[model samples]
Target: MLAAMPPSPSKPRNGGESHIRDRVRDRADACPGALRLHRADDGGLARLRLPTGVLTAHQVAVLAGAAERLGDGRLGVTSRGNLDLRGLPDDCGLALAELLGEAGLLPSAAHERVRNMVVSPLCGLDGRSHGDAQAWARELDALLCARTWTTALSGRFLFAVDDGRGDVAGLGGDVTLLAEPGGCALVRIGGLSWRVAAGDAPSAALAAAEAFLAVAREAGTGAWRVAELPDDRPLEAAVTECLAGAGVATSAASPGAVPVAAPPEPGVVGDRAVSVVAPLGRITAEQFRALAPGPGGEVRVTPWRGFVVAGLPGRAAAKERLAALDRAGFLTRPGSPWLTVSACTGRPGCGKALADVRADARPLDDAAVRGLPVHWSGCDRRCGHPQGDWVDVLATGDGTYGITVRTARRDNDDAQAQR
Candidate 1:
């Protein structure tokens, strides 16, 4: 799939109805994909998109070997449930691509980057969901790759298939499908939503995206996300027409708040699923080896910094497996310090960074941060910050740091403190 992308110009974009600083991206994003590596200060950076975040033990081994042989022997996890391999030698891109293709990780060259989908990772196994979101996710991924128009979607465009769980729906997907009771789903585009048959969720989601493209084209802006549309654009009307053109029926969603579920803690769920938290959202080859199940077992990585291994023999067995993972340095219990802290690739990895934030960051005890995340950044870009509430620890010149605490505050206020 990586090899399929033609060497296109990193073209700059122009013309738009209106633009906001955040939504106004004047250039196409050069976000690295598994095949499209980015030249970072830490050498080549390759991001592998894992739809549904499912990977087998064999795949894990392949990645581990690649990390050891090509990268810096560490696997970084993205908030979107994707995997990243950094510090790769420039000449090893072809080798990495070959390995990924052979492992079936690169299914469609054209659709690899657009496969930015996050679903309810613990769905089917937990029995806490209204429907099987994992099934929907797979079906949706297949549907996405089958259509050629989906290739036009920006790499940042994301899809969320939530099993009536609010956890991932709030993760900011351009097109979101929240499963509802009675075999129905709420398809949301921007703020507008429509209720449709669960079976048609994939088509509805695509239709909504098609509508976004139409509105964006009319706006004449190189807008990448639905939230970037001009103020004059009517999302609801456009989406409705697009769905109608697709021969899909829809009904206005009921007026209410979307339900949400907090992330699952590292433990056994019911009698089948077991979760192990990856400390600092980073894991090593040996750590991954310790977490892999025997042949035929499955692992589903979650949006949060860990993955859930379902298909356990029983609840008792899951406890044992989770305990083993804990021993291997995974955060297996709640209230662990690793749960409330994260940092970006500091100093040696990012050329723009002034400090090695990862090295300087420490796990924050719960009471210290009071359950709010504390992200350490090497510079003001504050890359890889968490989606929700958090404290920003940004490095300023001359060994000083700037701190900004943001949480539901659209307008931010900043404070400065010295190291």
Candidate 2:
């Protein structure tokens, strides 16, 4: 008999009650951008959107300096391959925007937040994958920025340019372009695919996004995402027609490719590359400063809440740094508890929150909790929940928590008794 897999932990239960009205139900809330910060209960939160997860050494230094000077000396890596700085002082938004713009980080003022794009971190690093997606990312970004109509697109809209490995496409992006042999590619929007040549990938993606926006506007139901549009809209066909109009030959593909599983692992690859994972997607300002390699070395913030430091000094030096980071609990090791846990700010940070979920979660030994990933939420909105299957631990107004497991559909209660 084969060895049995580990038994998954019991799913957390939810109180099944919520007091805050759903802002995203009718339309997506304006997610914070570097230009526009969101005032959280704790402080101002600024999200720096990275379209292709690419960043230069100098850019990384700028971010580190900004975090130290303008906000709390900490950086939060978002699930969308973006960077976030919390606890920013009032009136710092404009300065942050100007600094980012000067560094070529802010390409467009109107389309900043709407530039929701994610790419595989190992795209160019791994030889087995297709050619670098960086050039294509730039092309698509230019198309998005130049198009005035794209300003109307919601911040929730997502675009993924994958290099045939299906890494980012699996994130359920609104638009995905998957590479194939013979210079052909597959473009997918809302789970629908269209076959197109490699050269047309950028235009095809832009057209698909435009099609989604048009459908959403026509629906007039305040739908923010393509999936929210009624089924009758037929978004896929509309996108295909739009691509054709753009002089892009297209056809449908059967049963699109599946997403791949490659967690961000920190180590020295070859003589220069080093991958580092930010624990629970958060890193201190001091940590970032230490890792900011100057010139020749670049940082690629990944959608997986980690960053790859490339072009290091030497293999031995890179390995030593990686080992140090590992010891400091920055690397995503096999049994690291941080990998299985995520939490949203609660308590003083948000007036809508019922409890200090992060504070409560800080004491839990996640190593003791196995199986499904666990996300702690102060309210039912479950903001920042992992895209994949996870166990939900929701706080109730009565100072207790309800847990809901996605796989088992089981519920349980844990009282927050005093120690």
Candidate 3:
């Protein structure tokens, strides 16, 4: 069983790695964890990582209770399957931590920030996936919390576990595990991949991270991601060496691109799952409770700022649950104008915002956007925007806004309208 551990003292860096530490460029990653509250314009913000986005109904109620009593009476979902509780008092850190620890949310204080993992939301429920990514996530998360050296990893580091559906592999994780057919898995770092037995996937993935840390320490560039590492280092070779040292057997495989797959549409998924999205990725405490699964069921928070309630008895139960969620003001079906629309925390909540983007977005309709996955930003920072080609609605000044279509090759201004 996972339990909370006290903070451990920082270990000393070796002479060779310490010498190059001064040359590191990227500043320390200060991403907030459950214990570390980030002070925002609205109030203190606490981000809790949910490995594989698994949360019991009781856990959901606990979080909702915490949000109502400690911070703002709402919850925000991140693209990485994490929850953000905002508008908290400055001194609410201990209270928040206590609430989370009691609910089994904070497994380890030292490893809280580094426990970032996102698995396919509809993995086993949809019956489209080959293996259980959630199981791998559980194993990997426990392994991460047990190891002390993993605390050195930045909070931004991510692990994407795909059940061969390709849904999360393209989401960009520092280390990725893609479940393949015939009881095997592919462990990928950047362009390189090593095929290993399904049972060894988690260990291989951990070894990959260990290798990256070694390479990063050698380069001493404070690189938080594999893409940021120096070009000269052969990361694939390092990972292979680590895997061998860890006694994980691997087979040769060519470097291949990660598979790309979009998230499931918002509605009933298959026979036992229901997918729903909060309008603009924000929901009130009552609305959050409405998403709770039945006893023994689990809710999987999607990377697309949505929720997937799984483990239903059958199709009828899923439809009934979906109807209840739809009645609760969640976007449960398709054709909802807010389906692809999103906005940042603008106005009073965000000091840098030029306008209340959410308020401004509340009035728009299908005609307002010509494409899907449109995002409204308070400014150029464009926080919480969706990936891939989409419309960018940027707040300019006064009541005016700028609209542009962004693609891989070009940015074309489509219109300028008033909010």
- Can you give the TM-score per candidate against the true fold? 0.89, 0.85, 0.88
Weakest lDDT window of 10 consecutive positions for candidate 3: 410-419
lDDT per residue, candidate 2, 186-264, as tens digits? 7777646777778888998899888887766665656567555544225755775677678887654764345666555
Q: What is the lDDT of residue 158 in candidate 2?
A: 89
lDDT (tens digit, per residue) of candidate 3 on 50-105: 98798999899999999999989999998787999999999998888888998999
- Give Cα-based local distance difference scores for all models: 0.78, 0.73, 0.82
**Which portions of model 1 miss their true places by more than 4 Å?**
1-23, 363-369, 409-419
Preferred candidate (lDDT higher): 2 or 3:
3
Sorted by lDDT, highest first, which candidate order results? 3, 1, 2
Q: Highest lDDT, which number?
A: 3
Alpha-carbon runs more than 4 Å astray in model 2: 1-28, 327-329, 362-369, 407-419
Ranking by TM-score: 1, 3, 2
- Candidate number achieving the greatest TM-score relative to the actual structure: 1
Error of 2 at 289 (Å): 1.5
Scored against the true structure, residue 129 in model 1 reaches a CA lDDT of 82
